[model samples]
Target: MRTRPRGDAGQAFPIYIMMVAGLLFLALAFFAVGKASALRNDSQGAADAAALAAAQKARANFGLGFLNSLRANALDAFLIAPFAPPCAEAQRLANANEADTNSCTPTSGYLRDLITVAVEGRDPVDSPVLPGSEDKVAKAKATALIEFRCPNPKVIDADSNGYPEAFIFTCLSGDVVTIATADIERPGLWESVSRTLFDVRLVDQ
Candidate 1:
C-alpha cells in the first residue's frame, strides 16, 4: 500500500476547511438578507392595513345630521370636510399586526381623503452574519384613499322644511341607494349608507 505525502495532505485539509467556511458564511449572509426582506414585506402589509383602517373609520364616522344639512350640490363635500383623525384605529391595527405606528396623517383633497401611515416591525432583524443589524427593525409606509363612488347622485328637492327629503346615490357599480332624510333618525343608518357611497382603498403614496 502506498501512503499519501503528509505535506500534501496537510495543505489539502486547510483548503477544504477554508472552502467549507466560505460556503457557510455565504449561506448565512443569504439567510440574513432573506429574513430582512421578509420582515420588510410584513411591515409593508401592516402599514397598508393600518392606513385602510384609518380611512374606513373616518368614512364610517361621517355624521348623518351634518349630511342632512348640506345642500344638494354640497353633499359631495362629505369626503373632503375636515374631521378628526382616526389614528387610534391605525394604531390598534398596527399593534394587531405585530408592528408599531410611526405616523398617521390625514389629507383632504377635492373629492377624496387620504390617510397615510408609517409602521415599524415589532421584531428586529437579528442575524450573526449581519453585524450591528440586530437592533434594526423593518419599516414601511402606505396611503389609503377614501373617494365617493357615486358619480351622479340625485337629491330629491326639500319640502317646506328646506331639508333635502331624500338622496338617490347611483354608484359607479350601478348600485343605487335611496336614503330618506327621515332615515337619519334611525340608528346606524349613516354607517350602513356610507359604505355604499364611499370607497376605501389603498393608493399610491
Candidate 2:
C-alpha cells in the first residue's frame, strides 16, 4: 500500500489558490488602466476634430466678407474682421466622433483666428477594477488656428488713397494669386481664393 500523502502538499494547495487569485486581480487592474487610457485618447481626438472643423468653417465664412472688403477697397477692414461663430460645426464633428462638445470659443485678431473646443466622450471607462468607472467619462480640449498665409500683398495697382485696386499674393506654396477689385464680384470666386490665401493648423491651447 502507498504511504499516506504528505500533509505539506495539502497545505501548499491553498497557497497556490491564493497566488492565482492575486494575479487575476492584478491583471484586471491593469486592464482597467488601459481602458481608461483608451477612453482619454478618444476624447482628445474628438476635441481636436471639433476645434479644427470650427476653425475651417470660420475661415470659409471669411471669404464672402473678405471679397466684399476688397471690392470696397477696404482690405484692412477684412484683416481685422470678426469671425462668424462656428459652434454648430464643432458640435456636428464632436457628435460624429461619439463625443459631445462642451464648449466652442472663437477669437480673432489681425489676420489670425483661433478656435478652442472641449469635448466629453460618450463612452465611460467601464472597468471591473473600479466600482464607479462605468459612470466616469473622459474629457479633453484642443485649439486650432487659421491665419493669412500671405501678409504682404504685391500691389498690382493702387488708388489715390494708396489702397490696392489690384494685387498679387505670393502664398505659402509659392503660388501667385492675382485679384482685381473690378472682378471680385464674380460668383463663387472667393471660395477658391480663400483656400489659397489662408492656412489652418492645430495649435497649443
Q: Which prediction has the highest TM-score against the true structure?
A: 1
Per-residue alpha-carbon lDDT of candidate 2 for residues 1-205, written as tens digits (9 for 90 to 100) = 8887799899999999999999999999999999889999999999999998988898888877877776666778888867676899999999999999988887878878888999999999888879998899999999999989876777766767876678788887898898887777787777778778988889997
Using Cα atoms with residue i matched to residue i, what is each candidate's TM-score against the true structure? 0.90, 0.88
- RMSD of candidate 1 to true structure, Å: 2.1
Stretches of candidate 2 exceeding 4 Å from the true structure = 1-6, 159-165
- Give the TM-score comparing model 2 with the true structure, all chains together: 0.88
> Which pairs clash inside model 1?
none
> Candidate 1's residue-wise lDDT over 41-157, tens digit each?
999999999999999888877655346545444665655577776999999999999999999998887567788999999888899988889899999999999887876667698
Measured with C-alpha atoms, the lDDT of residue 20 in candidate 1 is 100
Which whole-number lDDT from 0 to 100 does residue 163 have in model 2?
Answer: 64
